[model samples]
Target chain A: MRELLERKLVFVTGKGGVGKSTIAASLALLAAQQGKRTLVGEIDAKGNLADFFETGPTAFKERELAPNLWGMSMDTEESLKEYLSLQLKIPLLAKVGVLARTFDFVANAAPGVKEILTVGKFLWEVREGHYDLVVVDAVASGHITGQLAAPQAIQELVQVGMVRDQTDWMIEILGDHDQTGAVIVAAPEEMPVNETLELAARLREETVVELAAVVANRVLPELFGRGEEEVFEALAADDRTPSPADLLGAAVGGPVRPILDGAQLAVTLRRTRGVHLARLRDELPTGTPLLYVPYLFQRSHGARATRQVAEHLAEELGY
Target chain B: MAARQRTASAGSVEQLLAAKEIVIHCGSGGVGKTTTAAAVAAMAAVHLGGKVLVLTVDPAKRLANALGLEAFGNVETQVPRQAFLDAGAEPRGELWAAMLDTKESWDDLVRRHAPDAGTRDAILANPLYKNITGRFVQSHDYIAMERLYEIHASGRFDLIVVDTPPTRNAIDFLEAPERMADFFSSRLLRWLTVPARSRVLSMASKPFYSVADRILGSKFLEDIAEFFLLFQTMYKGFVIRAEAVARTLADHRTTFVVVSTLESAPVREAEFFIDALDDRGLHLGAVVLNKVLPPWFLDEGTTATAKAMVADAVSLAKVLPEELGSPDQVGRVLREVGESFLNFQVVANREAEMRAELSAAPEVVASVPYFDHDITDLAGLLQLGEQIWR
Candidate 1:
């Protein structure tokens, strides 16, 4: 985490529903705790991350969400306007109403043009060095690869000029081992874990971006020991009806069988989660560090849960 | 098939599969939307006796694995009848699946709409076109919509199930055709077509050109000009296709099914998307809440009794570990189990609340519990379909 904070930019990506936004928010919070000025960039227009802090929708402009943390939701249109002005050096184009039309044309003419602008916004911020740490809560799994690859793709196709120069700089920042790193966030589930491994392999092969670590989110705690399994089985299999002695210390009325069944269910879940976590550890690149975040059973994923995860992250990463 | 009576609640998957020609699965990512789509398509083809084509617009190859097939290309491949039979489902109709090749679809569009072969090849060979079409942001969604229109027009299958990319991307998928139409007809596109006018304007804006040329190079600018020049004659074709797609999407037989999990975020997104569909006047058929934790069997009173019994066991275990041979360990395990059960109850209550909230608005809500294993095979999908349709 300290190394990640020292870098100018860090990207958190994973399969959707693996809590990327929450993890990204936590990383940003962790960075802020270390006295680094951090900007968390979310590409989601719906502003899911803003909800984590109970902040209103994150605007395109950065807002101070915490002491040293700022948040902004990337608007591709705004980014495109900025990119146009920067690349074309035509300040007039920024003011003209035609910019929106041109955006539409570019967006329609080229499928990935808007994506480049969005990614370029983060790279531009990283280059400016305003914030000590920049965290991009990138779009879901495969799209993250596309987002990271956009500048390079444009450079490859364009061959020369402002786009190429801009992408070259972006690539350098991303490719520099010490400057930028990508961390994958995933749940302790088969698909998310599989997708994370796939993304890691592709990230290694396709881009020069450094793979920082894998944050396995929602991992369950192992409660049963080897010796205890037999005891639990004996207890669970003892289906004999509870007598008055069993009910003597009871707090309420009804069958104890449901409780035993429920316990068995818990044991099943714990073992299942354990299996998935082991698989995740085994399948991820050997040297890549894996951090575990306990499954949050809270009613709502609010600030406290994020903070809890962040504290765990700080500890695990030795921050 | 019987004429199913329309009810206040969203109809079952069987009804939707039998009735609607187009069923689109839209949701936030990683809620098993793709798996659900594949399962529904499989169910429709194998059990319901309807020829179904499942179109995956996502870049991932998840749908193929979910349906127990090898990776499929842009062209539809029939799922071997033997696989369905092996899964114990006798099919009267065929199951076909395909992955959308964005570039190929765009190429097909060019082939269909370009004024001539020369113009088509010119646009196709343009490095700008090749790069953008293959990697552009909404190109996947736009080309996906175009492909949907093309296949639906062909009448290839009785039912077409589309697994959309994800939330906002799904919105883009829904709106792509109209946006593409607007782009083709926009004044800016017209302005770009007239090379002489662009040249005159560039001459007037000499400083901008000098900087742009120095940065982007003269060849890049020339490519841009030539690309636009080549596309100038194809705008009408683009608009016509877009219009045709828009009509296809709005067709009466088409329906959108928003899939989500029991979690707060996905539920919120699902409601928002349903409202967005309402705003667009698109018909929403159902909301499939995937991976919902099943309700606890023990009622509140029974749960209290169970809790008390477990507590009694823990107390006994702690006091008599030596006599009971690891009673303390037993207590610890029971305590953890009790805690887990309580947590499960909490989550189950939350799911119920979410379902009730969604149900209050009068949408068909089908809740499927979290399967113990990943649904990556035909048998798993069939079981999932049973749960959903049941």
Candidate 2:
């Protein structure tokens, strides 16, 4: 747990719909439970994170969802205004009225402004030291590279100024491997895994951030061994024979053939579960610590589910 | 034997190029839009003897890798000069490629086209303008339009092939330049500039002035004033340029090549994009259905058991129309899978259907079968070109 606290930022990213936000929220919860002031930020325009906290969309302005844990969905416009004021030292009063309105229009009109503002906001929060840990549920894979490079892009575009100064600070924070780590979350499918690997390669090529670990979510648990095969064979044999009325009580026989039919079904289910689990283990990155979250029967939304996930992560993170 | 089905007439890549000033290739993600765009440009250059430029907005950098170029930047790099020259014809025709750097290009546009230095400085200095234009604006679309304008203005390339982002993003990118230009030119923005303009005329008491001064701190207020003034001057030029590109896009030579896969979603997205093109009055060159699965699965005897199983399943359900049966069910599934391969002939034979409905538009020019291996290099583009032009 102390080793986990060594890093200031944890970026949980993966293919779209691969439970990234859930993992990010869980990590933040885990950190906060350890008494670290943690903040989880979501850059998705859909604002799905609010649902994770059992809150409404309007409840987005970094309210504490749990003890020592605050959450925010990146509000591009508001964050842009704050960034402008703080970095440029623009007086707060002067930032409003006509000037602010014009700024809003211009910001909305600018290319990559939404992405830059979103990333810039995240970078700002990271540099501000307002929290011991900040977890960003960044935009999906399609735009993540661009999102990650927003600060650098802004730095180059603005070139020598307060904007550049902020950019410099962000680069330093991100480049520090001990302070920043990225977790690539993926499912046990071909397309998402391929995309995740590609993303991992790209992140390695582009950023100095280290790959912490890969979280393979909703993995099926291994439930059977080779010993279950005999049960299936006995079930097959029972299907060929007529049901004996006294066979149910004669389970102590030498053959040990069960008169009950559901035993084979149980064995089959166990075997199928084992095969899927084995395949998942085989496909996952070897030697890299893999955290397998069991498939939830209920939708894993809201605080309760998030807490359950956090518990799983706590065990995986060796807490 | 099955009726000898004709392969859809793939309109010569050259013919399409000859016709459009701006040819936009659009499709769903992972359906080979980038490679197809490259092939079209390559074909237009090598076979047609015309200069061609292919612009890609895919952040994956696959386009650059496809052309064997080191990297895709805002500037156009000659394709033949890159490592993938073997893919082109001997005495290769001129092919240019550029990658869109949305933010930088937007800044460059602001600096280059702003009405005056004061206005430029003010707009650049204003944090709002800086953030909006730099980050929020759909840089890809603007840069694509800007790149087109630059290339079109340069008269260096006879045809420009633009590979739009995957279907959803492609539509957004195409609509972005106009949307962004309109946002900057809106009445709301004009009204927002009033305070900065009236600053000199207002002369109340010291406290009142101080309050107003605090509200519109002279520096920030002046920067906003400068942004509007400069924006006004640049707006007209930007609008005209966008319109010119739009007009070029609308021109007969500017063909909208809607690419798609055999998959239902990609096909559906392609259909939607075609509708969008029609809505914009953009010329539909042809639909190039890529990665189409072949229909031989039904004709083969080895798959007979599976076909029979499907038929039995269909018959037992009794949900299918009476005209559909065991062999027919197999054929229908095969047809659905291989629909892209047959789409061109189907569409051509039913021209009246296209005319009857607005959505039923565009002629199918070619159908390229799905490749066995992933298209990660120039060789893949060549293979795609062979299939497209065959």
lDDT of 1 at B286: 79
DockQ of all candidate complexes:
0.49, 0.06
List the lowest-lDDT window of 10 residues for candidate 2 chain B.
Answer: B336-345
Local accuracy of candidate 2 as per-residue lDDT tens digits, A1-319: 2244458887788865467778888888889999999988987654567777776663347887788989887776677556556544556556444454554664454333455667667666777788889888876666677667766665544433344455667778777777887777776543456677777777877666666667777553332233433322332343323422123123222121221222233334335444544554565455545677754433225678788888888888778
In the range B150-255, model 2's lDDT, one tens digit per residue, is: 7777888878888875422447766766776776678766654665666554342233324324433444445545566667778787877776766666666667
Which candidate achieves the best TM-score against the true structure?
1
Docking class of 1: acceptable
In angstroms, give how far residue B172 of model 1 lies from its true place. Answer: 1.0
The TM-scores that each candidate's chain B achieves against the reference are 0.88, 0.72
Q: How much does each candidate deviate at the interface, measured as C-alpha RMSD after superposition?
A: 4.0, 18.7
Native contacts retained by model 2, as a fraction? 0.08
> Which consecutive 10 residues in model 1 chain A have the weakest lDDT in total?
A243-252
Checking candidate 1 for backbone clashes, the offending pairs are A111-B136, A111-B137, A112-B136, A112-B137, A161-B215, A161-B216, A162-B215, B10-B364
- What is residue A78's positional error in candidate 2, in angstroms? 11
